[model samples]
Target: MPGRTGARHAVVRPPAAGRTAAPVAAGLVLVLLVLVVVRLPWVGDLGMHAATVQRLRHSPLDPGNPLVDADTPSPYYSPWMLLLGTVARVTDLPVFAVLRLAAAAGLALLVTGVWRYVKTLSAHRAAPALALLSLLLLWGTTPFLWSGFPGLHSLALTVSYPSTFTLGLAFHFWAWLTRAVRGAAGWGVWLGLGALWAVILLCHQFSGVVATAGAVATVLAARPRRTAWLRPVAGLSAGAVVLWAWPYYDFFALFGAGDGLEPVHRVLYGHPVARFGLVLLGVAALVPRWRRDRRDPLVVFFALGVLVVGAGWLSGHYSWGRALPAAVVPAQLAVALEAVGAGRRRLRAGWAALLTGALLLGGWAQAGTLGYVVPRGALPQALEDRYRPPWTGYHWITPWVRYGDVVLAEGRPARQIPAYGPYTVAPGYPDFFLPDEERRTKATGTYFAERTPESVRRGIEREYGVRWVVDRTGALDGTGLRAVARGPDGQVLYAVP
Candidate 1:
């Protein structure tokens, strides 16, 4: 019913920037991130973590969940992982549910990083709209913006939580590197970051490498200013030095073995080409960007990281996770360059179009993963269809829970925790095998850590308010715990005294 003149204007001119409807795009990105975390983590390794937690409480002295090393310092190597198990038992929440929440939070932080970077560059302009647009645009790219969700396929079809963490570190590194490249006093940031990278390498080795490399590349790309090359060489050299030492030993010391020199394959640098395509394309994208913002170190660091990591992946030394950090930079950068200037308008428009295309393709695949989303510490009560038993119906007892080690039992059976069963024979738990040090590493039994076996046992007894040991698993034969319960296909759950 509008007048022809008003209608004519609608066709003649796009709505004013103020009159333009606000995009639901950013909200959609967040929603997608949440959904991805829920669905993918539910099906991913988080289940294993939860199962491990359940076993600890269900069988405090069981060898499978050993705290003390039967032989080494500790029986199991996943001490950091056990913290989550403890959290699961202490809060009585589902472990996977908690993991999902954490993943979602990381995704939010990444979005914040991009928004902050954009504002830093254009604080005087319409930062809010630009920030929101940048975020939405980045979120739209596949393999570029990982969303850090469990199953959200960001470019490269790579997946994992540490990937997002690496990306976050990349943002911080870019800021400092840019200043450093410009001859600004920014060595402190690089040094501090390198130390932090060492810690990350210890926990999730690949993440550290990707973060370090990506940061350096972004720095160089940001300004590409030739500054004695000493800055980057020194920063990267420190990281290399750390990688060569620490976990193993000082590399130089190994050569003094007189008659020894072991040519061990570097596990990290193993895969190279497989990770190159996305990396190469990203770097290629930046070829023209150098003129737009020659001072931004983030672009340089990201470019180099991607190229080098991609080369590593192809060489069979790189892992997908290691390359993940670098890919996300281009995702954000593409959005950042879109509003540069008039001459570059078409190029920016094409970049936006291409990113939009990639996102549409990824979204098509993500459609299948929407329903499986569960939190880290808890599962939905309506598992009337999810699991078989022992692992199913368990949800009714607690709103949130974690998973523990899943054991597979073979022939003969074995000794187990007292809470896990009625023990009368030598094969029975708590009475059969002695807790040996060598066996601690090899033994499936996981009771107390060598550090505080007595303490942990006592604590377990006190925490659960039970004098009896409860070993819960599906295996038996050796001194391993037996499965007292099971799923329909015959997956059994054992117990001990």
Candidate 2:
């Protein structure tokens, strides 16, 4: 009888060793991420963000196009960047240093926010840790690095982006909303949540969409009481008010401006199988969740995300691909919840093994992210092979290129020079708000054409206040501009005569 009773108990409860291991593994992953944040290696869009901070620091109220000298308002001027800009101005810290600080704070918020939100889903002690690990590692073996996605490699690269900070806030917002809608809460809490929703939208519009989808799923799954229904309405009203009252840029105009963004975002739809194949496991996990409760929050959230992303692909509104997280995250969390909350002993063990295998595969695929913290040469041969070199910036031109000086350069230098407080003849990234963007682009191209008349080149120089020129070696050797410095990759910086 004692032996039979012990077997039943073991089947009912998870092993103590497994429970202890989950948290330890989670802690170690977070520590590794912190080291990456400390290194703060340059990658995609870092230049644009750094330049945005530089502009905001110098002129907060009127900071214009981040990569050019236009006076037009920019969408990048969010509440988070404003705060970081203030820090830069007051402390006189380099923009990248301030970015490192931002990265650390964002990482902390993300960690705590995940913990709080997962707690609302399950009382199981291991659920939060498992959820964190699942969120970071349940993607396909192919490494998909992007701003809004929080896969380990992507998060490491975009730790400093507004998307990270805003996504962190979104998790907290969802947690608070879940609790507020379920329990009796005052009108003030609802109104505050509404304002927070607006702030999240303002901070990173794409993440805001993801947050909104999750919010709807939360409310739907909760099936709040009739009295609680009015609270969401009041909260939404407050959010609309905040969005309207924001003075930096017209928030509503963004809805109609997706046309210009579609081209670049089209790439997000490529390689559907390679980028997200492993997530199907989570989808398989969702079947049991749906069977148990048809209106499961995770299922509802995944449905909504699929609705948006699928529509984006079909309708040519690919920019909506940013909402991929809405679908991806709920599925990831469902797997974690199942691993911890499964009822049958064999079923639970099966889920545990599957999740463990997926995580190991995903971690190895992103092992190259370790190169961000350790030297590339020091990485194991396999990791080094996977590692990508970060952008080598145009800091060499800083000695000659003063603040706000317009440089006529067309490729990578055009993208990177603005980070050091100089503007470029053409903005490296797309600029929907800049009225003369087309004209400036033409002027830059005309200046660089080999057969252009010297007089026409000089005219181009005076038109945009082009103080410097950066291009390939000997590209403009006879243009009469004084050669200021030569940088890596055959880039030459010339002072306009």
Candidate 3:
């Protein structure tokens, strides 16, 4: 029953005259909830993840592989999909609605955690509230928004990404770890830490890397004597081995053998110098506090965030770069909020104005995102119809697709049909773990575009075991496929027979 010892001295106390924290926190939650309501069934990864949940609901015992067109065994350790799928089954709710609800829940948790974590960093009432506002709205202005940057994809992908779910959970774990390391926690805290990491690892392997590393850094900072290291290191390693080892071992060889990176269009907003300048500004801002708060556990946490991004850029891994926001943003907010809470009257005012402006900009950016029909761009007429009520693009073709049937479809159709239906989509989204994913994806373009000869068609069908084709735009010229279904949007589903 050692309550948070030194809790009062943990951070600078808030000024006596500041506004109440509850209303601001509730407002932030409302904003996120509104977003979830407006943007239902988000396209891209969200849609795909929803598709996976839907599949799991029907075949809870054997969900098979939701990623591909065939029942190729899934190598992913996706506890998130299983959790949502189980909920969908029990509640009898539509998969898309489940996805939206999950998003709202995640955002709520994230805001609440932010509010709590900020209190540990600084006691300024506005610091926690302002930090929440800044992060949710001003995210687009960060370097992470750069086109091709990992941050853009990570945040934009929303609920579909297992990493996205980890955002709030990780922070709460962080708060608990800080308390536990300080000897304020009991045996239950230790158990909770281990259990949390296990869930994180099972949810996403990449998140495990960041979370485990962060946890280790936290333990090192706390420097707790007598078996302190044992619990964190042992717990994290065990979870990694149990959840991560199997999928990685199964897929690592294939991942390494896979082809090189394909080019993607970059979306650069500010000049390159602007990004660097922001980093410089952050470092400069931290310099004053370094002498005073250098040994602070949260300081180490912030350094780890910078290290993750720097290493990501040097190692040529986009995942690390994209994930920087999730791992680092909280730390960034903490740094700023602490500065605001601990600074003088004039200094605090300047910081507050900057944060407020950032929040406004962030809100504008979010508006733009919500206005878009799809995450990447405007959805095609075919895809637009797919999201509508009663029946959709996937509905038209799914009935004809049998289990284990490999169907050839273009990228849009490929991503959608297999997600909501029982069939596997041919040449679907590129999975780094799937060895031939890149090769198959490239060939898909050629197969759909060219006047493929019967010889080529037969060879492809023979090689990939393709039996049906969803021709969205009359892309099947030389491939002799018989039309079995015509879609509302001029889409044709062809059977090889």
Rank order (by lDDT, best first): 2, 3, 1
Residues 258-366, model 1: lDDT tens digits:
2211122233342434322223433555556566567344455555655765665566443343354455445445443443312344674575455445445434433
Alpha-carbon deviation at 217 in model 2, angstroms: 0.5
- Tens-digit lDDT track for model 2 on 252-312? 9899879889998998899977888878889888899899889888899999999999999
Q: Which stretches of candidate 3 lie over 4 Å from their true place?
A: 1-29, 60-62, 69-75, 142-157, 184-188, 244-284, 370-405, 425-427, 432-439, 442-446, 462-467, 477-480, 484-491
Tell me the tens digit of each residue's lDDT in model 3 across 1-497: 12233344333444554455424653854554455444543445544665678667877667656756444445343666677888999999877777766766665566676677666666655666666654544344432332112232224435335555666666677667766786656556676688787776556555555666667656767777775666666555555455545432243343452233322312221253433223333344455556665655555655776676666556654445434553345444654564455547677667555655544544543443333234434644433432322124476665777645677777677767665554543435555545567667766666776666677767776777678887777767445678888887788888875
Best by lDDT: 2
Q: Which stretches of candidate 2 lie over 4 Å from their true place?
A: 1-13
Which whole-number lDDT from 0 to 100 does residue 152 have in model 2?
Answer: 93
lDDT of each: 0.40, 0.87, 0.56
Could you report the Cα RMSD, in angstroms, for every candidate shown?
A: 12.3, 3.8, 5.9
With candidate 1 superimposed using the best TM-score fit, by how many Å does residue 294's alpha carbon deviate from the native? 8.3
Tell me the TM-score of model 1: 0.53
Query: How would you order the candidates by TM-score, starting with the best?
Result: 2, 3, 1
